[model samples]
Target chain A: MTLRLNLLIVLFLSFSALSFAQNNEIPAVDVKKIDGTTFNTGDIENDGKPIIINFWATWCSPCKRELNNIAEMYEEWVEETGVKLIALSIDDARNMGKVAPYVNGKGWEYEVYIDPNGDFKRALGVNNVPHTFLVDGNGKIVWQHNSYSEGDEYELFELVKKLSEGESID
Target chain B: MKNYSLLTSAASILLAFTLTFIGGELKAQQGIDDVLNNGEIRGNFQLEAQYYQEDSLIGAQDVPEKILSNGFLNLIYTNGSFSMGVRYESYLNALLGFPEGYRGNGVTYRFASFTQEKMSVTVGNFYEQFGNGLIFRTYEERGLGYDNMMDGVRVKFKPAPGLSLTGITGKQRLFFEYGEGIVRGLDAEFYLNDGISALANSKTQIILGASGISKYQPDQDSRYVLPENVGAVAGRVNITHGFFNVNAEYAWKANDPSADNGYIYRPGEALFVQASYSRKGFGLVLAAKRNDNMSFRSDRTEGQQNLLINYLPALTKQHTYNLLATLYPYAVQLNGEVAFQADLIYKFDKGSVLGGKYGMDVQFNVATANNIDTTMLNDERTTRQGYTSDWFKRGELYFQDINTQITKKFSKKVKGRFTYANLIYNQDVIEGKPGVPVIRANVGIADVTYKFNMRNSLRTEVQFLLTEQDQGDWATAIFEYSYAPHWFFAIMDQYNYGNEDPERQIHYYNASMGYNNGGNRITLSYGRQRAGIFCVGGVCRVVPASSGLYLSLTSSF
Candidate 1:
């Protein structure tokens, strides 16, 4: 048993190493538009500009706080970096009916989608809400953040600025 | 040795298949480039460990295993139209408050799937849900240690642009093993505006969905004749026009004697309806639900959130405030209940009277749940028929809450929120505590934040709960400081000041800090926890009080 376990671990490590050497792009998963139409995550794009994907839910307080703070400076961010924000709500059927109304009441201008079944969320390996991902112009995921603090949006904006300028960010 | 050999062969076969695919791609198309460039791999990991200390005062018992931990890792690989994944989970003796069945380490979940144009198929483990999840839903809630995933075959076909059909047959996962009953389901959905060209330019949009699910389990009881096959069906409709939207679903289940309903052969039914209207800056939603013996489970004897085949949505606002959320939290009455909720949100524009320099957001919500009226039948044991219920009649109130909140920016560097709630909790019913009186409470909270710079901030919260029963009245205060992109620290104390027993009046104090980097986070805390019912989406579990040191780490790539 131990030998078999060791073999499995070694095989997994090797595969991980090989995959890590290549660029990671977004996975294809189906999500729902606010209008109830199916939308594929692979088709998400912003004309070669940087794209920000934020996983949020109507019941999550930290997610609401993060989105509300970003809404205050979203226009400025777009003007400076030409970036687009995609807000994905992981609300299940119980609260899905409230998502559009909740987003509209907040007056947020970001493109919104619904992942009622959490397909896109699981595909992206998001364990919690308020998880943010920054995808570069070439559609390669560059940076990601878990959880949210008061000023985390500023750090996210900084990355967006760097990516828009074609500068490498680590 | 037999299990080891089987697993070894499976791994070897998978490795060989991958290598063969790589070789084939290299020979048929570009050399080695397609294999590396077209495939993507991603996964996540999480670990939580806690060290326990015996504190009899708070009802925390001694832990034989002084330290316990839970860990999970998920890995997925995708190439073009094909993808596969596996999850490894370990619970060293299982954590406190978690299901005991989750012991040892193993690969609990694995699946391979492929999609080509309009059809997709999954042949291993999968999660699925029908409309509103009224009749069938297989999912995982890691926080609750609840996972009822299906292990079988599923196929989805989208014959048209706006129409989708799905079929599934499987057995539910019962911890490390599979349930005895087999489940089969079929679902279909149609988007009228997109499916029919005549409605392509229509202002109103409509979506229709229907599903039917059945479970098969052999009857083995000698004293009673039990159902061998039980089936349920549900239908849903969603309509949207301009700023108005309405959605509703109704489900019916055939009679199947189970432990949840006391082995009474009663047909189950449920109805859920929601309507909303919203534009920029203002929104309103109204929802109502009715359930009658709607506790559908695959096993006749299993209980406590196991083998559940449907979800009963709690028609109430999911409160976030500490005092409002934890104290007197309501759980759905699976046996029978009627509930209603109303919510309104409006934002006063900047420069307006209530808006001032910065706009003010106001939210008001009210929700209530009551038992369904039922009359007992005379048949004691011969027929097993339970009772007849009045469809629209309301019985005793189980729970009620009215709450409101206002958020505003006081100045350039200051923002604050104020909230108040009035709650009526029927402890005897909601908590299953016999002889307990109905408790009424009032709660108020003030949360404020001060921004020092673009990268630094401080936040504080003061909350108070006034009640005359149970824990009496309580007060809590919290403070947190954050240096963005990296570090955050928080401390909190909750005092049961108004407890009738002086010796039981204790203060629960805790402090924690965390560091967050891209896709990685680690946190450590030491605290005294209070015993309470923790719930997510109406499903709940009792969390015992404990004093402990806790650590958590999570990362994704």
Candidate 2:
């Protein structure tokens, strides 16, 4: 009994050490917006612009909800703060055929790109869909969120405003 | 000596990596296809380390102590439509939790010849799942850490639209090697709605499929004449009429037995019937199943996934919510089971009384399973079909459950859900350990969320589970706070109030925080993860409860 208890304690300590070793606070990733042209990350970051990068899928319900929510407020968001939102669809070829139709049906204003092989998502370490990354004008990632609810868009806009003003906040 | 081997292998891998880099650079400088004509070499390696602790109360202990290390390396070369790959796997100090004889690594090869025109042939380790995976399925689930690779060759012929044929011959995977049996199978599927005239007249769609798998395992026991070769045949048809869909499949296996029925060889049979109705936001499904000693295997003597000939699918909703999922995981029994399940989901329109502001979603599910009745066979019978038994006797119900859930969004800032489930679980077949009482469980859960303005929100969940058998009663409470884009925090506690063991009657609590930036999100949590049933396929392994802080970081590039 004592041995089992001690083993549990050791496992706990090791896991705690692993948790501490994980760096939770790191500077945001700097990335350029995809437009079928102009693939320069440094120039995009130096322009002091806020970038909203959302990793999504065509079949994932939460991704649909997040994109629809942002679409409903995309006009207001752009007018309020000159922020650019980019939606990356990670749908493979099996489901990629639905992406164009789905986006057209929703009438989203954000730029859309395909990460069919999930190259960009892996680079960003995204494990789940509907993961959003907030990158500041300096192209450094400032904030991120996974999943979405009804009112999550409101919170997103607040961060966009703050980041556009060059404020360091969490 | 061990270090020397490691150094040699490491040097080889480094040399390969450097060569690949230099090859790519040189190709960029000069022209392409220089290395490709010589044969391109591409490889990838993966390593894993695991720590296992035993839990004795649930009969999940008895594993030998060891630090487990396993890795796999795959090297592939592709030219034109022909490709070849070799995979090597090694496990040093494999823990008792894993199967035996998985210590050494060797090369496993794959050669595939394919064309865009008519046919594709593959000779190597391959994964295939037939029709929802009933009669045959070979696949890998890395997280739960299970793989049933097929060491065989397969051919797929697609001469025309709506018709396809596949045939395979191989053996199932056994720890670091192959099972001691051979399997041969053939499957053909035909779609009635495509390239046909009779079925295309009325929006009617039909799919007909037939599959057969024969397993051969040599018998060694002198006391009983075990059928060295057993065969199972399954046929399924799916017909869709308007908005209603119906699918049915029937499978039968020749007589074969082992330790389950006292080695009384009994030819088993199973039948599955399912139907669903769906239009828009509302869907309903009903299914009934009956199975008897239908545990087809490559080797009847070895249990687990040794020589699985058929796969039985789970009939429960695969839950994702943390609190709802951790309590009980359903396990399927192949010896004998007569079961049925039903699911209904309806979504209410927005701006209604029930829908409030956004919409309301309600779901209900119920499932039940029972043992099949059997008659005593004369001890003198031998040869042919083995033991005789009744096909469909309504035996005692081994398990039953009913669940109902409701979700509604009152406004853009608030949403909530209410769920309740009543379950009856048989411990004998599920836990596999005798003397554990059957469990009658009643579970209730409520989750509510309220957003504070735009950038902040708070969500809370409370759950109560009452049971009189086994571990008794439990109650859980959870709270989460999200600060919009960047940060979120959660606190949760689960209390066992009716534990039969006094030492197990304790409260487990956890606190967690998460920060997401760009494509990376970091979550940190400290808490006690209650040991519970972890199941893949129809088999389950109980995980022991432990207090620990866990961190997981995943990235893709």
Candidate 3:
């Protein structure tokens, strides 16, 4: 057990050092808006503020919970840091019909888009939904986290605040 | 010995590079200004393991390999518009409910592609899906041990704005090797919003698309002659006007007898139509679909959710509550079925009667699927037409669900969500059981969240399902605690109190803890899992009963 733990630690440390530290803009991919308009996700910008990109699905419980939590403080977040939230539904054709209704019914004010074919998700190398990323104004991915606990939004909000204040998160 | 040496050499080289890269970071935090101008490397890894134990009461038995593990590592490198990636996957003895065919480990997926102006080409394994995947789709669902990505070449081209074309020729992946059949397909799409000047930015937008796919395989069966080559064609149209959007697709396939449809030499047909309208506070959507003998696969004899060339999703609500999902989840009827779904969403403004301080959101969805009315033709053996069916006629009720959910924020720190779902499921038809009666279940869920501080919170879920069919009534309670940025703990229990056999009534309990740091996470759990269908986005797999310890870790860089 000790040896295994040691090997794991070494592996983790090695990856942390050699891993890609890319400050890449969102890839140019065609995704549809709830209103049926097609837009390139890479063309989206925030005038040098932070953008919260969340990948979610209607069937993922954790995703809904995190989104709901963010909705409660969305107005304050926008007012305080000029941060914007973009929610992408990876629902596919099976439940693509429910994306619009589910979004409106949830009363979330975030900018919503549908990646019915998961083109954007694949480009980002996202393995699961509920994956959240903090993209800086320059379109560089500043930080990211997987999974959702009850209080995760607090951590995310703090990062947004920092990035908006011109604090170097990288 | 040769393979062992190759693996060792690869590991050493990787280790040396990592150490060299980290030498500078160890002394000083890598500055953003310092970036390698040459290229960029990124990847992710996930590892999951479970330790099993035997429990005779539930028919759970320990595997010879007590601890089974599955691991995946993906590495990608990019320079300008040119890029390459490879995925290494290992299934050490595989896991419960996972296909045992993936018992070993190797580099299962690899691809290299580059974009040059308006054209790009990819070589090696790739995932591609046509419009709504009615005719052809190649994808991977790792959790289900499903990966049928094509191996060969794919090309995507665009000569003008609003017009695009794609072509691919490949052999589908079957387990560790390529399948016997060869597949070729091409698709053309035209977008009016981009192509035509008058339609540009117009309230009305239209997109037209067509696709054709063909598969070739040598017939080996002597009992019945099978077509050496089968073809399918599909067409789709999508239009949007203001808040209203309409989309439809139809596909037709040449007759190719297979075991799935009892070797019936009848042409396959599928039609899908959907429309939706949405404004600020309200949205409405409706969809209809009909499928007849439309099971297409590269391998002729492949059955039971293997080597599927297309995806036919059930037009129904995808429930999340465990009981609501497992007991009556609807499987898309592949052979013959007609289905329809409708959804309505409304939001009551804040300060309104039902909105209180925070607005109230409500959504209701209803869907139903039934057998297509069919009658056998005269001289069934001689007539190539297996059966006659009306496009719109509906027969027995295979599945039905009506669910509604409401969300309201009562206070600054308290938020609640409530849901009610009623389902009617035909167990015999869906589960392929002969005598089981239809199951009717009503389920309710109350979820509440409490925030005590800036960094601390608690969430609770109370769910109850009432039914006399299946395993009787079930109730579940879950509580979770989170400390922002770092830690989370949760406990849940499902009690089957209404089981017919009192001795069999038991509590399925689980507890878990998670630690998160940046893009990395690790979770440890111990639990008793009940046998049921575990689903994600309407796709499901049967998870056998088990008592085990689970560990999962994922990291991205």
Candidate 4:
């Protein structure tokens, strides 16, 4: 039994190493629109512009702060780079009802969706909220961040600027 | 021993099958590019370890194992419409305040699923929930060490664009084992606008759903006669028109005595209703819920957040502030309770008098819970009917809170939020404290952020609580500094100063720093943690007060 377990672990590690070398893209999963209709995540697009996918929840304080900060500069970013931001709320059934109201109350201009059962969240391998991902015009994920801090939106905009200008980021 | 061998064999078979499939695909394609282009593998990993130090002053118990750790890794492979995943969990000796059943390590979850046309099938472990989760739900909350995933087979069929059906047969997971009962359920949902062509373009949209669930457990007890089979049913409806929405659900369960309700044979019932209205800068929500003898479990004798077959959502504002959240968190009373909540949010314009230069946002919320009025029967022992409850009478106050918050931008580089709250907590009922009087308290907080440049910023919070019972008055202060996309440092102190006994009045201080780089985060901190109840969505676990050094790492691909 131990031998088989060891073999499985070794194989798994090697597979992970191989996968790490490949370019990752967003996974296709089912989410809900703010109006209570099912929407396929594969259809998310920004007309060949950079797309910023942000995973957040209504109850997470840092997630709210991050979204609010980005909201303040979203118009400017769009005008300059033709960027689009999509906010995904990972609120469960208990708190799902408050999401639309909360978003409307804040007057946020970004497109918002709900993942009530966290199916999309799990497919994306998201461990925590406020995890942001930057996707290039070709639909390939280029950069991602796990947590949020003050002034992080500035850094995110910088990446968007680079991606729009056809500059590579390491 | 037999179960262990069975699981090991199953895992080995799965691994062999996967290897064989990959080999065959490679041979058929004559290259690895086909598999690499169509197939994807993704997962996440998290680990938390704590080194404990005994502190008799704050009631932190000595640990025989000075170091404890909890960790898990998930790996999922998906190819087109087929996917398979597994999770390996390790709890070395289990962390303090966690269930002792998590002593070792194993593959706790494994599943294979496929979708073809409009039908989906899942075999092995899965998580599922019915409408509102009133009658059935199986999920995981890692923060509370709670997971009730089902080891089962499930089938879902979408007959049309707006109609769906699901059927499931499984056994609920209990720690490293399976519950004694076998569970089976069926659910159906219909969207009116999508299902009927006539209503497709209507202004009003409606959705209706219903579910039925049953569990079978063998009666083996010698002391009393028990029912072997229990069943529950629920129905829900949702309506939306313009900017208004309403959702409601009702559930009922057959009488099956269990440990949570003191072996009462009374049937269970629950009702939840919510209404909301929202526009661009204004929103309002009102909700109410009532539950009676609704603690349904697969096992008859299990207690303490275990083996729950249904979820009773707590109707309260989930506070985010430390003092307001951790100090007096409310837990749902599964047996019987009536609760209501109201919330209002409004945002002033950018250039208005109250909005200042940037804009201002205000939110007001109120929530309350009360015990169900009940009357004991004359021959309750013989009938085992327990007691009868009045449908409209409220017995006693369980919990209440009224709070409001205002957020304003002072300038281009400054933003602030202020909050005030009043709370009334019944210690005896909610916390299981006998003979303790109710606690009435007021809390206030001010949080502000200052930006020095585009890359550097600092945020601070000052908070205070005034109370005459329990831990008495308290104050807290927090400071955090961030350097853009990479690093952050935070420090906070919580002081209990108005205790009758100064010896018990102590200061809990903590400092932490974190580093984040694209999909990976690492944090290390050392601090004195005050004992409190930590909750998520009304479900709670007691977090013990401990002085320790903590480290955590999370990563995803």
Task: Specify the highest-lDDT model's number.
Answer: 1
What is candidate 1's lDDT per residue for B351-421, written digit by digit as tens?
99999999999999999999999998967576778999998798899999999999999998999999999
Most accurate candidate by DockQ: 1
User: Any idea how many clashes model 1 has?
Assistant: 0
Local accuracy by lDDT, each model = 0.87, 0.63, 0.81, 0.86
lDDT (10s digit) by residue, model 4, range B259-354: 888887899999999899999999999999999999988888888878888888888888888889898878889889999999999999999999
Clashing pairs in 1: none
Off by over 4 Å in 2: A1-170, B1-115, B259-262, B321-324, B378-392, B452-457, B481-489, B500-503, B512-524, B536-539
- In terms of lDDT, the poorest run of 10 residues in model 2 chain B is B28-37
lDDT of 1 at B329: 89
Q: Write candidate 2's Cα lDDT for B451-531 as tens digits.
A: 887768888889988988777899999898887666789999888878998887777788988775443456677766676
Q: What is the TM-score of chain B alone in each candidate?
A: 0.96, 0.82, 0.93, 0.95
**Candidate 3 chain A weakest lDDT stretch, 10 residues:** A6-15
DockQ for candidate 1, C-alpha atoms: 0.56
Per-residue lDDT of B518 in model 4? 88
Reference interface contacts recovered per candidate: 0.62, 0.11, 0.44, 0.58
lDDT of 3 at B88: 84
